[model samples]
Target: MRIPVKHPWTLPKRLLGTFVILASIGRIQSEQKSSKQPNIVVIVADDLGWNDVSFHGADQIPTPNIDALAYNGVILNRHYVLPTCTPSRTAFFTGRYPIRTGMQGKPLSVGEPRGIPLNVRLLPEHLRNLGYRTRLVGKWHVGYYTNEHTPTRRGFESFYGHYSGYISYFNYTISKNNHTGFDLHQDTASTLEMRRNSNYATDVFTEEAVKVIENHDATEPLYLHLAHPAPHSSEAKEVVEVRNMSEVNSRFGYIENINRRKFAGMMMALDQSVGRIVKALGDANMLDNSIIVFMADNGAQTEGFLENYGSNYPLRGLKFTHYDGGVRGVACIYSPLIKNNSRVSEQLLHVTDWLPTFYSLAGGDVNDLGDIDGLDQWSAISLAENSARESLLINIDDAVNLRGVVSGKFKLIEGAADLYGNYYGDTGNNNSYPEYNITEILESDAGLAITSIGNSLLTETKILNLRSASIVRCNNFTDFANCSDTCLFNLQNDPCETTDVSADYPEIFISLSKMIEIFESELVPQTNTDVDPASYPEKFNGFWMPWVASDSSTIIATSSLIGLINILLHIFSLIFFS
Candidate 1:
């Protein structure tokens, strides 16, 4: 103990000790932060309108849990997606435009012969390759006519829901003339048809999601896509009904309209489901560390009469249009990695941008994305200086009349629109609304910017309802290039595409036109354009059979008879031998 204080190595030894302690602490912190990449829980609601949530200034029904999520995270004010379901979902999975995937302006019906396309790698496939357990707990409207096109065959290790845009919450059965069967499924097999139960889809799906979170392997990161079909539609075809009738009176008894009341109840249930999932994560000790993304596939169908009676109020257009109301959605990303919370982001975030973003967060190299449309936005959403994407290639439906793109504050819309805000069919000079210049509509204090879409018998039918207001006619041409109309607007000054700045800014118009041309060139030829869904290939073979029919009692009786006969034969044989 006689070491002198004047020793040469004394100060150096003390500094070395300090450095070692600091290094160990840094390592521990890094380990805790980067344990196994945050679990990605993407909760998508079908047809959730812009003004649907309480945070979006809606007093009809307060989505407190959902509002809490938005307040605790960042509100994606400029988030954009496709006008329809399958198209947006296609863009989400492939990290490419829906036009490229042949789902440009239409959704895959009960038995469309085409889907995500073979040789295409989905978000789940890429994540699964990286040892992530991918689970899809709801709607998969992309495709399902064949076993190969099913969700389980795609990328998800497990899938538990319907293969269509929407389904009945209770009966779980659909009867569309020649196109009818059980919709619920576990993996590829129809669950409702197999087990035959009476459970509301929303509740059953929530329970399944909780199970997925609880039973997840902690060693691997998880990608759970809980897509809820709520406030969308039921078997009644664009008719809204709440699965939980008890909640209707409790949450929205004051709503005078039965349709609106049912919608409010469904929305309440959806909010409760979000809370349940959040709590489940907490129970599993994965809450604080998990990254939850809450968003909708597309805007709600607000412009159609008796069509989902949902409202995207304040936003100009409805579903199946190029209006901000149709494409823009309510979205938020919550995680500890995000530095700024309880704020709004004006950056242009696209649905296609999620694949690369999630992949980047999961420790995958962004360079491996490879020509994918989805840019890695991990840093941007994580409180980085700027988001990875500045502008978005908003909508590109060459098959129709209405389509546009968002660059900075400039938006170029090229098409005609009917009173319903849909450009699908010909308006025929009746109540022809301005698709490009809606400055008054956007600035007005009107209840709804647009009126109800009253289609004839062609309602919710095919896209070929030429006389109906579903299409812009396109010279009634079946070719993709027939949509030659165009309009441009400055969304900054005119949030409604009101002012025809296209004539003023010829350069911008030409630039957007060039981009659209290039994107269209890359688009795959359209498929599943058949007028009748029943005529789609492989319509009957193994798909048309009702897996859980009401007459299944006959099959059970037959099985019992066979069993009795077999037992009698065995006993008689034994007696004869004795």
Candidate 2:
């Protein structure tokens, strides 16, 4: 290849060097453009226990995908939400207290018209205004029975899935068809039906989710809400494919063998769903730019028919109770933006925080939205910083009577009458005489049946008495006098809620009680003004909707200006350097 060496011009060599430098600059500018916006995906699991995932010490189930997320991102150890599904979801959606939005207790059945207020802007609505294509796949339980509460009405551009409290995993049902049963829907169109087969519900939800990801527009950033309803029902199919077999037997003694197996199966399917979503995003080359959030709506189901199988042990109480087990949940955020993969304890975050956090991460205007009760934790995500709220107040009752306040490690649970009315010897009929003498029964009980009955009664009484003693005057509102015990505990030392430190720390108890009183007095409505008029048909807005700003023009203008500057700089640099 020894060819003739003509005095090849130094001008060409200089031009080549300039081209190389210009290409390098252009590549850097492209990298900057990609970093401006990131995709977001929030995966919400229904009724998953704190210990159910492998990262949280569930040996009986192999949630490797979920564990991988924790290994790569921040695992929040002190994440909390309301005790039930609807309240937690409402908070997550609106960044406001569930009580503030008037969605408490169980979510409304399908066709019910209640929804997040028009005045309160939802997370997706704000994100959508900022130019994100929002989609919700899976459970939309916020307002199932009402058209006003549908996903499209709540800010989602497209909605897929059912509208009901609970549907069969094999034979899923929709509330729109009177709950008898119908195929899942995408908007108003029927998608699929498992009429004669037992296809797992989680599988169906996951499959549809992948489709949504696959079909998403590549140019516009995507915000997908995959709210899976699985591992939540009493009859949910359990997977028995665990590394540790004995762990299942020891941990889930209350659930029957069959149900436990079914639960395990459901969990396995859920793990697979997570894996699938991750794999799909990776295949699409979107994994590095996407933020994946995994969280349960609340603690495991602790009552009704599913009590035995769903245990929140090591944490007292269950789904409906205002206890750690009911409110505390497993939460984690996976993002390339987060540099460290470690457990974040001490930070007290709630469901409401998701809205502002996601908004800030997506580059949305936080202040343009209405009043929100959450703080943006984007700084905490990128850096190992503690960004949490000062306090979390829970109003489990409409009257603000049954409530709890958690500040730091101190949790003040207001002792109110057991709404379940599980008091021993007190027949639900107040007129009936007490069936058994409380003293004689406690002394005589030794067998499993007697011990169980006695323990139940004692627990109920303790909760009742604690409520009564804490209040100076017992109003029939919460029926504090009917409760057997009122108590306070330093949750820091007693995470299990075993020891009552109320007597030892009377001052702490008094302070918490006074705080509760102040919160109740300020927030709880003394008159009918608290009642939401939207619940009534007469208060309909007559098709009125918010004036959503069209941001595409601004986005196009900004992007075009950036591209033009990059191009012009490259051209000028090449010409001058050459």
The model with the greatest lDDT is 1
lDDT value, residue 275 of candidate 1 = 76
Q: All candidates: CA RMSD in angstroms?
A: 19.4, 16.4
| Top TM-score hit | 1
In the range 1-578, model 2's lDDT, one tens digit per residue, is 01111232433798657656766765454344434668899898887776566555334444656755554566776788887777888889888877676675454543344555544557776666445789998887665333334577566888877655556566564323222444355764443343444566788778888888898766667899999876677232432233234654554433444555446666767877887787677656667677889998877764563342444544555676676767788788877667643444446788888898887776555674457788887776667677668677765465535778777767777754354222111001122212222233223211112232221223335423322322112112122122324556566666655555677888877888887777666552322222223332122221111112324444334434443344445445334542
Off by over 4 Å in 2: 1-35, 144-146, 174-179, 191-198, 234-256, 302-308, 399-401, 416-485, 522-578
Work out the TM-score per prediction.
0.75, 0.69
For each candidate, the alpha-carbon lDDT, in order, equals 0.65, 0.59
